[model samples]
Target: MPAVTADTLTLPRLPDLPQTATAWRPVREVVRAREFLEGEGFRVRRPFPGVGLANADPFLLLDHMGAVEYGPGEAKGAPWHPHRGFETVTYMIDGALEHRDSAGGGGLITDGGTQWMTAGSGVLHSELPPQDVVARGGLFHGVQLWVNLPRAEKWTPPRYQDIAARDTTLLSSGDGGALVRLVAGDVAGFRGPGATRTPITYLHATLSPGARLDLPWPEDFTAMVYVLAGRGTVGPERRPLDEGHLAVLGRGGALTAHAATPWDVLVLGGLPLNEPVARYGPFVMNTRAEIIQAIEDHQAGRLGRTQVPHVTAADEELS
Candidate 1:
């Protein structure tokens, strides 16, 4: 669960909120993530899309990978695949993953690093554990978020970004009660390293027991908080939120999280695209016809050529 770490006392702190100056966002619902096997049969807890895509507008899916410890030969990863009309943000919180796409845009995304890939138009990509992870066995945990691209940018181009741990903008709570790692978009006045095609803010935060986070938020964005580890409460009403749970928030210019114990959570929100979303296995589009076109394009090899490179033990030693 070491997504990113820093001594709060030594970091820049967020400005304290005035008691009556702003409003605390209220909790709309707390949805528990349902477990599903993804990418070569690795288990992940997905919290939305099941809740309905309308609730997560501009965002299609949220997959929470393991905090599970894997024995030798038990690790798994996503096989080569195709995507279009959206972006994938894969954040490695505890282990390493190798990402290679047809455009040759990827690398080792290990502890506290991230791989942001835009599948605009379409592309073939594969996500696999580095040979060492599968051979020697260790802990592997991460998150993959699917951000929808606007219709205008759907065919922009396929690209990628490798955001290392040190590249994240770090901040702390007013009283140094929590640590914040800004991954994308703006927070107050500070910004993250991720360059998104849509308006959004993504961040990971760790709070000490009994600590509370008062975050300045954009009123135009839809907000939600997902607990990664430990227990916590969200909103002014103090609604309960535990691990694998997501709290969808209501309108306000600010949000709050009060920890019951040491907790790690991801806070994200984005301007609602308010557009129709038609999706299938891996393709996301604005209409069923578009989705069909995507599948046809992929089957016709328009996405990109698939190159399955089986990693060998010797490869691990060299890497």
Candidate 2:
């Protein structure tokens, strides 16, 4: 739905970095810290939490979930889980989450809410943790992204789109920055709402101190930038990312983001399933005999939801 217009920034050409010297190493820095997601008896934390896929062809995942501080009528969660062919995006900031799934779909996100699940072909979800947001302590934080489903829509079926917050579509600049284009397509000129089966693109920036932004990506798609708050400067080789960093950008142009004291980022990207993936566990098939027939259809249960648990080591594994 390309109607974006506000000082337009061009983009549309990527996939060529591969010849040597770390493939020209343009911008492949990933530095994360501040990782914490405790609840349900926090004592160094750990509860269905996850943070895997720091890098994978085209971009596979990136989960840095929770910011913690729950309490009253608690709801720490992560129950029924299962996915196929990929596509899950949840972005909140400052408490609240209660998504349900199995197709009927459920909801309850807060602070700039944006859920966007697309477990193409299969889906059985749960991400509860909201009872007035840990009983009023406030600040739970969020960020969950996993995209890669293009083998002709990888199975094709399960879908969702919760995007709230006045239907997301804001853009501002000059000091106290602002940007929220919650899904594939449009920015600067503002034109984002929800519609991402895989031509992905999502933003939710906020900068103040020193403000500066130019972000506009889609050069064949496969971008990245996840620094949720403070610390910036990212393109033109500005470098110096901070706040749970992850700035992997190689193609395209126009990405400046320079905040240093007041920042919040999320500029994602898409269009890179290039083919052959074959992941197991939660199924991301593309081969391997369709991930062994999706693990024999969830172990012959026919995967209808009701039982899909059994993943532990204290559970918090993500690759």
lDDT digits (tens) for residues 260-279 of candidate 2: 67777777766776687878
lDDT of 2 at 303: 54
Provide the lowest-lDDT 10-residue window in model 2. Answer: 1-10
Candidate 1, position 86, lDDT: 94
What's the TM for model 2?
Answer: 0.34
RMSD of 2: 16.3
TM-score of each: 0.94, 0.34
Clashes of each: 0, 4
lDDT of 1 by residue, 1-319 (tens): 7878899999988888875777889999888899999889999999997943335987999999998798999999998999999999999999899998886667899989988888888889999998988998899999999999999999877877778898888999987999999999898898888888999999999999988898999999999999999998999899999999999999999999999999999999999999888889899989999999999999988896433233322332355
